[model samples]
Target chain A: MIPIVSDLAPLVCGLLLAVTGAGKLFGRRTAQLAANTVLVRVLNDGRRAGLALRAVGAAELAVAAALLAVPGTLLPGVATAVLGAGFTGYLGYARATAPESSCGCSAKAEGPIGVRSFARAGLVLLGGAAAATATDPWWTEAARRPGWSAAFAVAAALLLCAVSADLDHVWLLPLRRLRIRLFGNPLAGAADGPVPVAASVELLEQSVAWQAASPIVRSALLDHWDDEGWRVLRFAGVYEQAARGARPVNVLFALDLGASIDTTSSPAVRVSVIDDDTDEMVPVDLLAGMATRQVLPMAT
Target chain B: MSHRQNDPGRRGLDRRRFLTTAALGGATIVGASALGGLDADAAFAAPMPSLDPAISRSAFAEGRITQIKGSVLEVAGSHGDQHLIQLTNATSIWKLRTTTADQIQVGDGLYARGVDMPDGTIAADAVWVNIVNLYCTVKGIAKDRLHLAHGAQDHAVVGHIVADTTTASYLGGALTSDLSRVRIGQSAQILGAWRPADDAIDIARVTVGH
Candidate 1:
């Protein structure tokens, strides 16, 4: 069992390398994808990143071919080990410098570097180490024990898919989708719950009242409370006094809570300006010709 | 927030009607056509008024909240500046939904528009917290959530789908509340608000099929 598994390690690693290298070498989005990786920063040029990506891909393919064609040779295994070590170091640098950048190891993987990436790199290292000690080729082992070899290959393929974000849409997402369909979604009740505060803000921003008072109003919401059925939004503002300059004020907006973005109901909004010094309600009539006062000649 | 009224079409006329009707009244609470003329592109920040520019600058503050002191938030601006944001009962706090000031936490990013008080404190009017515009891929889908994969600092973001609030634009078509068109593995740009408590996002709009 141990000997056969050891022999199979090189074959499995070679297949992964072949797939990953092909994506880097032949994928139409290679250059675009490389730009999203740490390679662009490491190489110090966008164009150089693409070149580096292709070079790594070529190295992977060569190692893969060597592992497959000459598995018993110590030289191929040593070369695979060297490549694996380099990959591990590169992944570490990528994780540290650009924690959010994609591994770009597989070229197909766009997901950020995580535990799975380190594990994949480790697998390559281990596989290469095992391949170095392998006496019989993977083909010979498979021919000698066909059923065991086939089952092992399938299991290895599934494990590879589990770690590969590029293949998530194929199996993992479907499984998750199936689970969500069967057991019900985790986020189902949230939508049916209360309307978000943003909806109210959106409704307020659209109202004619908001348009009228916006010129006087300044600042984002300072605080708000539920007064009866209305949501009151407050902001900092200044009342323009023509040549007298602007007086610091607080803008208050009372919007009907029943209104929401989903509903077709027209948002009814009321505005008030308070004198910061006097604490008196500044009449809205002062700003009569504000943005909302325009009389459109073409109105129905 | 764009109000480019270049068209003389029906939509433009309706916008003008919405703007003109009850625009500036004594009561300042204009109803009727004020609410009636709103289309899909509801007046977000209608044509910028010819109001004083200095007043606009003094009334607005933007940056990350470095400290939360009671109802007052200490903000460190994007530039080299600091501000004290004062929140009161009249202030509307929007995280993803219209929420209270208590929903706001330290380190949350915000855009504040308010009165620049004599004491240098900004009496906030509207506060938007953690407003995020993310270009992501729908890695997985649930009944009420879209598992988004973004490239920025947050790689995997759980995007909550609000029933009535979350709208989808498919193949550059009309926006609809039907999220069924959002497929697994499709790339999308989601406009949302972040939840600091759970690190998830409440999606406002998801643009897909591009």
Candidate 2:
């Protein structure tokens, strides 16, 4: 089993290299994908970074072709090993220098250079080393032990797929969808929990009462309390009267406690302003006479 | 205190209805209000001898909540500053909605606007928690989510698309639910509830070509 596995290792390595090489050279949105890599940081130019990716792709393709055409050959195996080592070193550099950069190990823009990247590169290096020790080509070994060789190939393919983020849609998302279908989402409780305070603020902000009183309101909600069943929201505001330039005042907005974000019903909101020093209500006549400032986007 | 009935059927009812419809259609109400009005046309533009200094001296406290001992929050700012924010019944706490002080979890980012008290504490009137304004590159677009590479530091985030709630603003245009114009590699501004769970954002608005 060990002998057959070693003999077939080169073929697996060739398959991986071919896919990645082809992707790097001809992948959709290649420039955008390359920009996500450390190559852009290294080269300091978008076009140059793309060129560098293509160059690397060419090298991988050459090595892949050699491995495929001359299976079990020591030269191809050693070349594959060298390429793997270079990849590992480059990944380590990329990780340390630009921690946020995608591995760019494959043509796909995988999030960041993580453990999986190093492991995959290490696998290639080890596989190459093992392939170099094989006396027979992969086809010859498969012919001798057909079932074992087929199983080994399938296992290698599964292992590669496990570490490949680009192929996640092919298997991982499906498996995740199945899990969600069988057992409800873990975040359902939090999502279905009581309405958050932000929603109330959203609702209040949308109200015409808020729009009219907003000019005088200065700060975010300073305090809030329940009056009867109504939610009373308070704020620190400056009421600029005709005579008093900017009198520091308290603004209160009252709305139903059960008010939610719904287009069907427009809940009544009451807004009031009180003078801080005089402890008197700011004249509603003044509030009523204030001009409405236009919302810019709405004008467009 | 004073208030007038918000009669939608008053004179200029069409304009009022237009404003209401426009506000409802846009998902960026939180963000737009958060930005605040510049060059505000004061309700009464006039001169006064005694311009109250308290109105001009609004204390602002922004940072992560290091400690939450009941209503008073101990916050550590990014600039090594510490602040004590006091929440009251009138003080509104908003985290994805208007909520109570109990919803404010420790380690959550906070911005408090209030009056400064003599005890070196702020009497917070409004508090917004875990609100994020992120500039991102659209890496992948799914039916239910957007894979984004956010900020210069390159944090990968998942932006969830809530039906009827999430909106898109295109080229400085009006906000709409039609997100067909959103494509991969577009630069966008995401204003939403950035939660710690799964590093995801319940996106309220995505503004592209801004």
Maximum-TM-score candidate: 1
lDDT of 2 by residue, A47-126 (tens): 89888888888888988898888887798888889989999998999988986687777876667777889998998898
Model 1 per-residue lDDT at B97: 52
lDDT of 1 at A108: 67
* Candidate 2 segments whose C-alpha is farther than 4 A from its true place: A27-31, A43-46, A190-193, A277-279, A290-300, B1-155, B158-210
lDDT of 2: 0.69
Per-residue C-alpha lDDT of model 1 across residues B1-210, encoded as one tens digit per residue: 111112244124453233222222215364423422111122133444444564444466778999998778999999979999887654556676555666788989887766678898997766777877789978888777888888742378899987667876667333555666666668898878888778789997888987
Candidate 2 lDDT score at position A246? 71
Backbone clashes, candidate 1: 31
- lDDT by residue (A62-165, candidate 1, tens digit) is 98999899887787777778888988999999999887787787866466788988888887887788888888999999999999999999998998888776
Top-scoring candidate (lDDT): 1
